[model samples]
Target chain A: MPPKMNIEPEPGDQTPEVGAATDVAPLGRDHGKPAHELTAEEDADGTDWGRVAGESEFKGLLASKRRFIVPATIFFVAYYFALPVLVGYAPGLMDTRVLGVNLAYLFALSQFFMAWAVAALYVRAAGGWDETARRIIERLHSSRKEK
Target chain B: MSTPLLMFLIFVGITLVITYWAARRSTGSSAYFAAGRSIKGWQNGVAVAGDYMSAASFLGIAGIIAFQGYDGFMYSVGWLVAYLTVLLVVAEPLRNAGKYTMADVLAYRLSPRPVRAMASLSTLTVSTFYMIAQMVGAGALVSLLLKDSGVTYQAAVVGVGILMIVYVVFGGMLATTWVQIVKAILLMAGTILLSVLVLAHFGFSFGNFFDAIKHVTYHAAAGKVVTQDFLQPGLRYKPPYGALDLISLGMALLFGTAGLPHILVRFYTVPDAKTARTSVVWAMAIIGVFYILTTFLGFGAATIVGRDVISKNGGTNMSAPLLAQAMGGDIFFGFISAIAFATILAVVAGLTISASTSFAHDFWTNVIHRGTERAPGEEVKVARVTAFVVGGVAILIAIVLGPTANVAFLVALAFAVAASANLPVIVLSLFWRRFNTRGAVAGLGTGLLASIVLILLSPSIMTVDPPTVTGAARHLIQSPPLFPLENPGLLSIPLGFLGAFLGTLTGREPSAEARYTELVVRANTGLGAEKATTH
Candidate 1:
C-alpha cells in the first residue's frame, strides 16, 4: 500500500483514528464518506482554502485561463452569429453561388469546422493548465507535511 | 409483428437487460445519482452526445431541413456550437466543485436553503418542458410507425414513459449512462449508412448532389408545382420577425447547453475535472460530425424523396424515415425507425434522472430537511419516487396534448430558461467574490419567470393560425403577439444577469465573501474532490 498522505482533520472534527479507519475501507477513497453524505458546510474542512486562493500560483492559473478562454469565446460567438445576421439582412450576397452551393449554405457548413477547430485549440491549452494545477496541489501537500 | 416493431422491441429488450444488471450494482446514493464516478472520458462523452441529440436533432431538424431548406439547418449549427460554451466555461469547474446536481455548486458558497430551492424549481420547470416535447414526439412517431399493428398514440406514450421510469428508478445513473452510450452508437451508425446511401444515389459526386438540390421540384402549399432553389435561405424564417427571431434563437442555443441539468450532471459522473474536459472534447467531435451529416440527411430527403411525397406520407418529421424507405427499401426503414425510438427513450431517461436528482438532493434533502437525509437511503428513495411521478406526469400531459400538438416551442422555451436562469448564477458563483445567496435566488427566480412570461406573450403562444389548423395544433392565444421574437433569450439573459447584480448590491454578506476563496480553490485545483471508487 502507498504511504498515507499528510492531510489533517480540522479541530473538533473527526479524530485521526476515525479518519484512518474509514480511509482503509473498500470502494471510494473519500474516507468511507460518500459525497452525498457530506454537507456543503463541511466540504472544505481540512484545507486552508483562503490561503491557497491567495497564492500567486492560483492567480497565475486564473489569469492564463482567462487569457485563453475570453478571446476564444468572443471569436466563436462572433463567428457563429455572423451567419444568421448576414443571412437575415443580406440575402442577395448570401445567395451568390460559391462553387456549387450558395454562400449561405457554405457559411453554415463552415460553422461545424470552426467549432471543431476551437475545441481542439482549447483542449491543447487546457493541457498546460492541468500541469500548473498539479504543481499547485503538490506544493500545498508538501507545505501541510512540513507543518 | 412488422419488421420495424420487431426491431424496436429488440432494442427495448436489450436496454431492459442492461437496466437489470445495473440495478444490482447501484446500492448507495453516489451509484444511483452519479454511477459512482467510475465512467471514463470517452464513455461519458458518448453518453453526453446521446443525451443531447434527442429526437429533436435526429428527426425534427432533418424534417425542418427537408421542408424549409437552408433555414432548417441553422438549428443543427446552434446545437453543435453550444458545446463550445460547455467546454470553455462550465465543464471543469462544475466537475471539480459540485457533487450530484447543478445546485450543489450554488449551495457550496451561498446560503443553502434559498438558493437550492430556486435552483430546483428552475431545474424541474426546464426538465418538464423538455420532457413533454420528447414524450409527445415519441407518441406521434410510434403510432405512425406501428399503424398496421393497431397501437394507439396513448399506448405508445405510456409505454415510453414506463420504460424511462424503469431505467431511472431501478437501474439509476449506471443504466442511464449505458443506455445513452448504446443509443449514441446506434444513432451514429444509422446516420452514417443513410448518408452514404444518399451519396451513392447521387452517383458518388458532390456536383451531382448539389445539381439536384438546386432544382428540387415539389408541390407548393397552393397545390401548384414549383421548381425552387433549396440551398438558399428565407424559406421558413421569412420577413419582419424572422431576422430577430433567428438571432434570439441563436443566443438561446449558444448559452443554454452549458446550463442544462442533464448535460451538467454528466460531468459529475467522471472521476475528475480533467476527465470531464476530455469528455467534453469527445462529445463535441461526435456531435459536430453528426450534425454535419444532417446536411446529407435533410437535403437528400428533399432531392430524392420529394417534399410532396413526404407531406402526403407522414408530414414533416417522417422525412428521414421515408428517405430511408426510398433509398434502401423497407428493411432500412425499420432500422432507422428503431434508431429514432431508441433516441427518444435514451433522452427522456437522461432528463428524468437529472430532474429527480435535483428534487431529492437539492430540494427534499437540503431545502426541506436542512441538508440531512432523515433515514438511511432516504435520498435515493425520494429520487426513485420522484422519477415515477415525473414520468407519469409527462405521459399524462403528452396524451392530453395529443399527437399533432406543436411542441417545437417547448424545446425552445427549455433552452431559453436554461440559459437565462441557470447559466448566469453558475457563472457568478464561480467568478464573482461579492455574489451571495440573494443573487443566486434572484437570478434563478427572475430568469425563470422572465422566459416563461415572454414565451406566453411571444409569437409561439399568441399568433393566430389559419382556420385549417385545428385542435391541439393551433396556437394557445388567437390575438396577435405582443412579443415579436419566438425565443426570449435576447432579452431574458441580460435581465437575469441584471437581477443577480442588483441582488448582490442589496446586501453585504461577509461570510459569502470569505467562502468565495474556498470555492475558487476547490473549483480550480480540485483539492477536496470526491475520489473515484476502485473496483
Candidate 2:
C-alpha cells in the first residue's frame, strides 16, 4: 500500500478537498529504463497527484508561468511577424534609411537583441518558479513521512 | 589531397574518436537514447544549437542573402525568435514529463498506444524529410567544395551517410551530442573569423560596408550589367503571392521549430527542467549571435566575391566558401568547407538519433510490446538498426535525387508538418483538460495529411518549369500551381487545432481527463521527473 500523505498547506495555500489516498505502490525499482519507458499499466507513482495539483502553490506556479509566458509569446510573435509583413507589404517604409542601413535592416537587426532580451527576462522569471516548485516538493516530502 | 579534403578528414577523425569513446558507454536504453540524462546545461545548449543550425541555415541562407539581399535575412530573424516558443512553451514541461521522445508527454495523459504510434510516425516523417534535404545539400556542396580532390557527388553522399550511421549505431546520443558541441564551436569560430575578415576588408567601417551593399553591380541575364540595391527589400520575394508566401514561411519557422523532433529530443538529454530552460537560453544566445553574423557573411560575399563570380564558380551555396577564398585565400576556403561539412554531419547525426529513438522507444516498445523491452538492451539494439536503415535510405534518396534538385521545399515541408501535426497536439495535450486520445490521434492525422496534401498542391510542387529548367531542377508536376502559397503552415496549423478540438467533443475519456491533473503536477513541479543516472 502507498503511504498516506499529510502535507501542511502553506500560508495562502488552499486546503485540498480530497484527502490523499494510498492505492498505488511506490515505483522503487529503476529497472535501468527511464520513467516513461516503464509499464503504462501502472496507475500512478504512489503519489496523490490530484491533491498535489489542487494545492494553491501549484496553481500559483502555473499562473506565474502563464503570466510571463503568454505575454512574452505574444510580444515576440508580433515583433517577429512584423518584420516579414512590413518588408513584404510596406517596402517604402522598410527602405527608409536609418543611421546608414535601411529601416528594414535595422528592424531585422533589433530582432536578435529582442530575442535575447525576452530570453534573459524569462530566465529571471523562471528562477522564481523554481523556488515555488521547490517549496511544493518540500511539502510533498513532508507529507510522505506521515505514513 | 586538397586542403578542403584534408580538413574534412581531420574533422572525421576527431568525430570518430568521440564515437569510439561513446560506444563503450552506451550499453543500455537510457545511455543510448538520452545519454543517461547527464549532459550539463551549457553543453546541451551548445549541442542544441549545433543540431539546429543545419546546412540550410549556414550555406543555403547565406547563398540566398548574398544573391537576394534584404529578403533573405528574413529567414535569420524567424529562426532565432522561434526559440522563444521552445523556451516559453515546450522545453521545461517536456524535460520534466518526457523520457526519450516527444510522445512521452502525450502518453502521460492520453491513451499510450495510438498517440505513440501517431507521434512516432510524425517524428519519422519529419526527420526523414529534414534529413534528405541535408543529405542532398551535403552531397552537392561537398562534391563542389572537394572537386579538386576528385570526390564525386555519389562518394560524398555515401561517405556522409556512413559516418552518420556509425555515430548513431555505435556511439548513440553521447557521441552525437559531443560531435554537435565540437561542431558548434568550430562553426562559431569559422563564422566569427570570416565575419571579422569581411569587416576588415572594408576597413572595419559599417558605413563602408553599407555603402558597398547599397550599389552591388551584378551581371543580370544576357550579360547586362545592373547596379542593384541590396539594402532594399523585394528582390527575392516579389508581387502577387509574395507577401502571403513570406508570412506563411514565417509561420512555419516560428511554430515549427519547437515541434522539431530532433530539437525536442535534445531536452531529454539534460538533467532537469531548469537545465532544459537554461540550455535553451544558452542556445538562444549562441544561435542569435550566429544568425546576426549572417549579415556580414551574406553581404560581404555579395560586395567582395561578386555574384557573377560566385555563380560562375559553383552557385549561390558557394558564396561563403568563395568569399573565404577571396578574402583569406584557399586555406580559409578549405576551413569554411570543413565547418560546413561538420555542420551537415552533426545535424544528420542528430536527426538519425531522434528518428531512431522515436521508433525504438515509442513504436517498438510501447506501441508494439506494451511498454516493456522483451529483452535487456533490445531498445538500444533496435535504435541502432533503425539508424543504419534511416541513414542508408537518406543516402539512396540523395543519390537518386542527384545534385541539382530544388530540395529547399523539403525543409519547408518538414517544418510545416512539425507545426501543423506535432505542435498543435503537443500544445493541446499539455494545456487543455478536454484533450484525449481521440483528439491526439485526430490532430496528428489531420495535421499530417493537411500539410502533405497542401504542399503537394502548392507552388513548391505543382509549379510549371520553364523550358530552360531541366533534369533535377525541373518541377515534379509540370502544370500550373493549384495552391498559391509555397508554405502550407498558414492553413494546415489551424486545421490541426480544429481537428484536435472537434475530435475531443466526439468522445468522452474520463480516464484521460482524470490524468490531466497528474500530468500538470508532474510537468509544472517536476515531481517524479526522471533523475540523472550516476555512473
Candidate 3:
C-alpha cells in the first residue's frame, strides 16, 4: 500500500476512523441533506474551499489549462474551417493534387490525425495540472493537520 | 422486413435477455441512471463510442459522401475534431461535478430549483429532437432492409419504439451499456468487412481505390452525369452562402458533441474523473477510424456500384448497404442490415436513458420534490415510467412525420439546440466564477428560444420552391427563408454567450460567490465527488 498522505478530518467533523469506514460503505444521495447544506456543512470535514479556489496554485492550474485549451480550440476551429473555406472559396487550390489525390481530401483526412494528436498532447499536459491539483489538496490537508 | 428481419429479431432478443438480467441488479436510482457507476474504463469507452457513432454518423455519412462526394466528408471531418472540445473542456469536469445528469453540474453553483428546471427543459428538447431523428432513420432503414419481408414503415417504427422503451424502462443503463457495446462491435465488424471487400475490388491497393474513384461515371440525385471529380468539393453547396453554411455546420458539430446530454451522461457511468477522461480518447480513436473507413465505403458505393443504383433504390442512406450487396451479394447484405438495426437500437436506447434519467432525477426528484425522493426506489420507478412516456411521444412524432421528413435537417436542429442552449451554460458555469442562477436561466432560455425560432425561420423549414411546383406547401410563407442560413449556430451561439454575460452583469446573487469556490474545488480536483454504490 502507498504511504498515507498528510490529510486530517476537520474540527468537530467525523473522526478519521469514521471517514475510512464510509469510504467503502455505499451511500445514497443523502436525501435529507439539503443541496447547499452538504457543501456548507463540509466545514466539519472538508477543506477551506474559498482558500483553495483563490490560492496561487489554483490560479496557476486555471492559467495553464487556458494556455492549452484556448489555443487548442482556436487551432482546431481554424484547421477544420480551412477545409470548407478553401474548398468553397478556392476549389482550385483545394483540388490541386498532392500524393495523387485532391489536397482537400488529403487535408480532411489529416484532421483525424490532428484531432488524435491534439487530444494526446492535452492528455500529456493534463498530468502536470493533476500534479498541481494534488499539491493544492495536500496543502489543504497539511494545514488542517497543523490546526 | 427482409431476410434480415429474423436477424434483427435475434439481436433484439439478446438485448431483451440482457435487459432481464440487468433489471434485477438495477433497482436503485443510481444503477438505473448510471449503471451504478461500476463500468470500467475500456467498457465505458466502447459504450461512449457506441452511444456516439449513431446510424447517421455511420451509414448516413456514407450516403452523403456517395451522393455529395468530398462535401459529405467536410461534415465527417468536423465530427472528429468536435471530440477535441469534449476532451479538453467538458469531459472530466462534467463527470466530477455531476451526479446522474448534466444538470447536476450546471446547477451546482446556481439556484438549484430554477436552474435545474431550465436545464431539464434543454435536456428534454435535445433528447426528443435527437431521438426523433434516429427514429425516422430507423423507420426508413428498417422498412428498406425488410422490404422483401412485408414490413411497412409504420410497423418498423413502432417495433423500434417499443423495443427501445422496453430496454430503457426495464433494463435502464446496464442494458443500454451492454446493447451499445454489442452494437459497437457489430458495427465495426461489418464496416471492416465491407471496407476490405471494397479494397479487394481494387487489388488491395489504396492507390488503386483513389485512382479508380476519379474516373467512375455515375448519375447524381438530379440525374446529371458525374465522374470521380465528384471527388471535388462544391458539388453539394455552392459559393458564398454555401461556404457560410459549411462554417455554421462545423460550429454546431464542434461545439455540439460537448453538449449532447446523452453523450455527456456516458461520462458519469465511469468510475472517476480520470476514467472519464480516458473514455473520451477511447471513443475518439474508435470513432475516428470508423469515420475514415466510412468515407471509403461511400467512395466504393459511388464508384464500384454507381450512384444510379443507390439513388434509384432508396436515396443516399442506402449506399453502404447496397455496396455490401453489390460486393458480397445477398448474405452479406442480410448481415449488414442486421448490424444497422442494432446500431439504431443502441443509439436510441442511450438517448432514452439519459432523457428519462433527467426527468426523474432532475425534474421529478429535484424540481417537483425539492431535491428529495420519498423512497429509495421511487426515483428509479419514476424514471422507468418517464422512459415509457418519452418513448411513446417519440414514436408518435416519428410516425406522424413519416420516413421522408428530412431526418438530417432535424438532426442539425438537434445539434444546433445542444450547441446554443446547453453548451454555453455548461462552459460558463465551470470557468466563470461570477456566473449565477440568473445567468444560467437567461442563457438557457435565450439560447433555446433563439435556436428554435431561427430553425423555424430558416430555409430547412422554409423551402424556396413554390407550393404549386413542389406539390406541397412546405411553409405558410412561400418565399425563401428570412434567416438566410439553414443552421442558426453561427448567430445563435454568440447570442447564447452574450445572454449569459449580460445576465451576469445585470443580476446579483451574493450566494453564488460562496458556493462558486466549493464548486470549483469539486469541478477541478474531484474532491467530494459523488461515489458509486454497490447494487
Instruction: Put down candidate 1 lDDT per residue, B222-299, tens digits, no spaces.
Output: 889999888889988888878888898899999999999999999999988999988998999999999999989999
Candidate 2 RMSD to the real structure: 7.4
Which regions in candidate 2 have their CA more than 4 angstroms from the true location?
A: A1-44
Interface RMSD of each: 2.5, 2.9, 2.7
The residue pairs in collision within model 3 are: B1-B146, B2-B146
Clashes of 2: 0
Error of 3 at B343 (Å): 1.0
List all candidate RMSDs to the true structure. Answer: 5.1, 7.4, 6.0
Best model per DockQ: 1
DockQ (CA atoms), all models: 0.45, 0.41, 0.40
Considering only N, C-alpha and C atoms within 3 Å, which residue pairs clash in candidate 2? none
| CA-lDDT, candidates in order | 0.91, 0.92, 0.85
C-alpha TM-score for every candidate: 0.94, 0.94, 0.91
Q: lDDT tens string, model 2, B133-211?
A: 9999999999999999899999999999999999999999999999999999999999999999999999999999999
Chain A TM-scores for all candidates read 0.69, 0.70, 0.65
Instruction: Fill in the DockQ of model 1.
Output: 0.45
